[model samples]
Target: MAKQQVISPLPGTFYRKSAPDQPSYKEEGDQVAVGETIGLVEVMKSFHEIKSDFAGTVTKFLIDNEDAVMAGQALVEIDG
Candidate 1:
Protein backbone atom coordinates (compact mmCIF):
# COMPACT_ATOMS: atom_id res chain seq x y z
CA MET A 1 0.00 0.00 0.00
CA ALA A 2 1.27 3.41 -0.94
CA LYS A 3 0.85 6.36 1.38
CA GLN A 4 -0.81 9.34 -0.16
CA GLN A 5 -0.18 12.69 1.43
CA VAL A 6 -3.34 14.58 2.29
CA ILE A 7 -2.44 18.20 2.67
CA SER A 8 -4.36 21.17 3.99
CA PRO A 9 -5.43 23.57 1.30
CA LEU A 10 -5.36 26.63 3.53
CA PRO A 11 -4.08 27.82 6.88
CA GLY A 12 -6.60 27.16 9.63
CA THR A 13 -7.57 25.00 12.54
CA PHE A 14 -8.38 21.44 11.57
CA TYR A 15 -11.45 19.88 13.11
CA ARG A 16 -12.69 16.33 13.03
CA LYS A 17 -16.37 17.12 13.48
CA SER A 18 -18.97 19.60 12.42
CA ALA A 19 -19.43 20.41 16.08
CA PRO A 20 -17.75 19.55 19.31
CA ASP A 21 -20.41 17.02 20.30
CA GLN A 22 -20.70 15.44 16.88
CA PRO A 23 -18.90 12.46 15.53
CA SER A 24 -15.83 12.87 13.45
CA TYR A 25 -16.15 12.99 9.67
CA LYS A 26 -14.16 9.79 9.70
CA GLU A 27 -11.88 7.60 11.74
CA GLU A 28 -8.90 5.41 11.07
CA GLY A 29 -9.62 2.44 8.76
CA ASP A 30 -12.57 4.14 7.14
CA GLN A 31 -12.61 3.93 3.36
CA VAL A 32 -12.84 7.23 1.56
CA ALA A 33 -12.86 8.40 -2.02
CA VAL A 34 -11.80 11.50 -3.84
CA GLY A 35 -14.14 14.48 -3.34
CA GLU A 36 -15.55 13.03 -0.16
CA THR A 37 -15.88 15.45 2.74
CA ILE A 38 -13.46 14.24 5.35
CA GLY A 39 -13.38 17.12 7.79
CA LEU A 40 -13.69 20.86 8.18
CA VAL A 41 -11.22 23.66 8.66
CA GLU A 42 -12.07 26.90 10.34
CA VAL A 43 -10.37 30.05 9.22
CA MET A 44 -11.32 33.58 10.16
CA LYS A 45 -14.67 32.34 11.48
CA SER A 46 -15.45 30.63 8.18
CA PHE A 47 -15.83 26.92 7.89
CA HIS A 48 -14.35 25.18 4.87
CA GLU A 49 -15.10 21.62 3.95
CA ILE A 50 -12.05 19.49 3.78
CA LYS A 51 -12.27 16.69 1.25
CA SER A 52 -10.32 13.65 0.31
CA ASP A 53 -8.27 13.77 -2.86
CA PHE A 54 -7.62 10.05 -3.15
CA ALA A 55 -9.56 6.83 -2.85
CA GLY A 56 -8.40 4.52 -0.09
CA THR A 57 -8.57 3.64 3.57
CA VAL A 58 -7.63 6.31 6.13
CA THR A 59 -4.23 5.12 7.13
CA LYS A 60 -3.71 7.85 9.70
CA PHE A 61 -4.59 11.36 10.76
CA LEU A 62 -1.48 13.50 10.95
CA ILE A 63 -3.05 16.47 12.69
CA ASP A 64 -5.23 16.56 15.75
CA ASN A 65 -8.64 18.14 15.80
CA GLU A 66 -8.67 21.82 16.76
CA ASP A 67 -4.98 22.05 16.13
CA ALA A 68 -3.66 25.09 14.34
CA VAL A 69 -2.47 24.04 10.92
CA MET A 70 -0.57 25.67 8.12
CA ALA A 71 -1.27 25.67 4.43
CA GLY A 72 0.15 22.54 2.78
CA GLN A 73 0.40 20.74 6.10
CA ALA A 74 -0.44 17.05 6.01
CA LEU A 75 -3.79 16.46 7.69
CA VAL A 76 -4.56 12.90 6.81
CA GLU A 77 -2.65 10.00 5.40
CA ILE A 78 -4.48 7.79 2.90
CA ASP A 79 -3.37 4.43 1.66
CA GLY A 80 -4.09 4.82 -2.02
Candidate 2:
Protein backbone atom coordinates (compact mmCIF):
# COMPACT_ATOMS: atom_id res chain seq x y z
CA MET A 1 0.00 0.00 0.00
CA ALA A 2 1.09 3.52 -0.68
CA LYS A 3 0.49 6.46 1.60
CA GLN A 4 -1.50 9.32 0.12
CA GLN A 5 -0.08 12.79 0.65
CA VAL A 6 -2.10 15.66 2.07
CA ILE A 7 -0.46 18.96 1.16
CA SER A 8 -0.79 22.45 2.49
CA PRO A 9 -1.66 24.91 -0.26
CA LEU A 10 -0.28 27.98 1.52
CA PRO A 11 2.14 29.15 4.15
CA GLY A 12 0.22 29.64 7.36
CA THR A 13 -1.00 28.13 10.55
CA PHE A 14 -3.01 25.01 9.71
CA TYR A 15 -6.33 24.71 11.47
CA ARG A 16 -8.68 21.77 11.60
CA LYS A 17 -11.79 23.84 12.00
CA SER A 18 -13.28 27.28 11.39
CA ALA A 19 -13.48 27.81 15.14
CA PRO A 20 -11.56 26.54 18.13
CA ASP A 21 -14.62 24.93 19.67
CA GLN A 22 -15.48 23.03 16.48
CA PRO A 23 -14.49 19.53 15.62
CA SER A 24 -11.65 18.71 13.25
CA TYR A 25 -12.26 18.49 9.54
CA LYS A 26 -11.16 14.91 9.57
CA GLU A 27 -9.45 12.26 11.63
CA GLU A 28 -7.35 9.15 11.10
CA GLY A 29 -9.11 6.13 9.55
CA ASP A 30 -11.52 8.49 7.85
CA GLN A 31 -12.21 7.80 4.20
CA VAL A 32 -11.34 10.71 1.96
CA ALA A 33 -11.49 11.45 -1.72
CA VAL A 34 -9.21 13.35 -4.01
CA GLY A 35 -9.83 17.10 -4.07
CA GLU A 36 -11.66 16.92 -0.76
CA THR A 37 -10.98 19.69 1.68
CA ILE A 38 -9.21 18.24 4.67
CA GLY A 39 -8.23 21.31 6.60
CA LEU A 40 -7.52 25.01 6.38
CA VAL A 41 -4.45 27.16 6.41
CA GLU A 42 -4.63 30.67 7.80
CA VAL A 43 -2.41 33.36 6.34
CA MET A 44 -2.95 36.96 7.37
CA LYS A 45 -6.36 36.01 8.77
CA SER A 46 -7.47 34.41 5.52
CA PHE A 47 -8.21 30.72 5.44
CA HIS A 48 -7.26 28.44 2.55
CA GLU A 49 -8.42 24.91 2.04
CA ILE A 50 -6.00 22.02 2.17
CA LYS A 51 -7.23 19.28 -0.10
CA SER A 52 -6.52 15.60 -0.44
CA ASP A 53 -4.39 14.62 -3.41
CA PHE A 54 -5.58 11.04 -3.52
CA ALA A 55 -8.46 8.80 -2.48
CA GLY A 56 -7.85 6.70 0.56
CA THR A 57 -8.28 6.25 4.26
CA VAL A 58 -6.31 8.65 6.44
CA THR A 59 -3.55 6.81 8.25
CA LYS A 60 -1.78 9.64 9.94
CA PHE A 61 -2.11 13.28 10.86
CA LEU A 62 1.25 14.92 10.31
CA ILE A 63 0.55 18.28 11.90
CA ASP A 64 -1.59 19.25 14.81
CA ASN A 65 -4.31 21.85 14.45
CA GLU A 66 -3.27 25.48 15.02
CA ASP A 67 0.33 24.56 14.19
CA ALA A 68 2.43 26.78 11.95
CA VAL A 69 2.78 25.12 8.56
CA MET A 70 4.65 26.08 5.42
CA ALA A 71 3.48 25.80 1.87
CA GLY A 72 3.60 22.23 0.56
CA GLN A 73 3.84 20.91 4.09
CA ALA A 74 2.67 17.35 4.63
CA LEU A 75 -0.45 17.38 6.75
CA VAL A 76 -1.71 13.85 6.57
CA GLU A 77 -0.84 10.40 5.22
CA ILE A 78 -3.48 8.10 3.79
CA ASP A 79 -3.37 4.46 2.90
CA GLY A 80 -4.25 4.01 -0.72
Candidate 3:
Protein backbone atom coordinates (compact mmCIF):
# COMPACT_ATOMS: atom_id res chain seq x y z
CA MET A 1 0.00 0.00 0.00
CA ALA A 2 1.07 3.51 -0.74
CA LYS A 3 0.41 6.51 1.50
CA GLN A 4 -1.18 9.65 0.15
CA GLN A 5 -2.22 12.95 1.61
CA VAL A 6 -5.36 15.03 1.30
CA ILE A 7 -4.30 18.58 0.76
CA SER A 8 -6.30 21.62 1.70
CA PRO A 9 -7.20 23.96 -1.13
CA LEU A 10 -7.67 27.08 0.98
CA PRO A 11 -6.36 28.76 4.06
CA GLY A 12 -8.89 28.73 6.87
CA THR A 13 -10.18 26.92 9.93
CA PHE A 14 -10.61 23.25 9.29
CA TYR A 15 -13.59 21.41 10.71
CA ARG A 16 -14.07 17.69 10.93
CA LYS A 17 -17.82 17.80 11.21
CA SER A 18 -20.42 19.93 9.47
CA ALA A 19 -21.81 21.06 12.81
CA PRO A 20 -20.81 20.67 16.45
CA ASP A 21 -23.31 17.89 16.98
CA GLN A 22 -22.64 16.07 13.75
CA PRO A 23 -20.34 13.12 13.31
CA SER A 24 -17.08 13.50 11.41
CA TYR A 25 -17.18 13.06 7.64
CA LYS A 26 -14.38 10.52 7.70
CA GLU A 27 -12.59 8.97 10.62
CA GLU A 28 -9.32 7.10 10.87
CA GLY A 29 -9.41 3.69 9.21
CA ASP A 30 -12.47 4.68 7.21
CA GLN A 31 -12.62 4.02 3.50
CA VAL A 32 -12.69 7.00 1.20
CA ALA A 33 -13.48 7.36 -2.48
CA VAL A 34 -12.34 9.83 -5.03
CA GLY A 35 -14.17 13.17 -4.85
CA GLU A 36 -15.53 12.37 -1.40
CA THR A 37 -15.85 15.14 1.15
CA ILE A 38 -13.67 14.66 4.22
CA GLY A 39 -13.94 17.97 5.94
CA LEU A 40 -14.76 21.67 5.64
CA VAL A 41 -12.64 24.77 5.67
CA GLU A 42 -14.17 27.97 6.92
CA VAL A 43 -12.78 31.13 5.43
CA MET A 44 -14.18 34.49 6.37
CA LYS A 45 -17.40 32.88 7.52
CA SER A 46 -17.72 31.03 4.23
CA PHE A 47 -17.47 27.24 4.33
CA HIS A 48 -15.82 25.13 1.67
CA GLU A 49 -15.96 21.37 1.38
CA ILE A 50 -12.61 19.60 1.26
CA LYS A 51 -12.59 16.56 -0.95
CA SER A 52 -10.18 13.71 -1.37
CA ASP A 53 -8.56 13.23 -4.76
CA PHE A 54 -7.43 9.70 -3.99
CA ALA A 55 -9.43 6.59 -3.18
CA GLY A 56 -8.13 4.84 -0.08
CA THR A 57 -8.43 4.26 3.66
CA VAL A 58 -8.02 7.19 6.01
CA THR A 59 -4.80 6.54 7.92
CA LYS A 60 -4.36 9.68 9.95
CA PHE A 61 -5.46 13.26 10.35
CA LEU A 62 -2.70 15.82 10.28
CA ILE A 63 -4.89 18.70 11.39
CA ASP A 64 -7.20 18.71 14.36
CA ASN A 65 -10.82 19.83 14.25
CA GLU A 66 -11.28 23.60 14.07
CA ASP A 67 -7.57 24.04 13.58
CA ALA A 68 -6.02 26.67 11.36
CA VAL A 69 -4.70 25.43 8.06
CA MET A 70 -2.98 26.87 5.04
CA ALA A 71 -3.45 26.22 1.38
CA GLY A 72 -1.59 23.11 0.23
CA GLN A 73 -1.33 21.81 3.80
CA ALA A 74 -1.85 18.13 4.37
CA LEU A 75 -5.05 17.49 6.28
CA VAL A 76 -5.10 13.72 6.29
CA GLU A 77 -2.97 10.78 5.29
CA ILE A 78 -4.47 7.92 3.30
CA ASP A 79 -3.26 4.43 2.56
CA GLY A 80 -4.21 2.90 -0.77
TM-score per candidate, chains pooled: 0.95, 0.91, 0.98
List candidate 1 stretches off by more than 4 Å. none
- lDDT scores for all predictions? 0.92, 0.86, 0.97
Q: How high a TM-score does candidate 1 get?
A: 0.95
Of 1 and 2, the candidate ahead on TM-score is: 1
Off by over 4 Å in 3: none
Best by lDDT: 3
lDDT, candidate 3, at 39: 99
Better of 2 and 3 by lDDT: 3
lDDT of 3: 0.97
Q: On residues 1-80, what C-alpha lDDT tens digit does candidate 2 reach at each position?
A: 88767788689998878688988878888899988888999999987888888998999899998899988789999999
The per-residue C-alpha lDDT of model 2 at residue 48 equals: 82
Model 2: lDDT equals 0.86
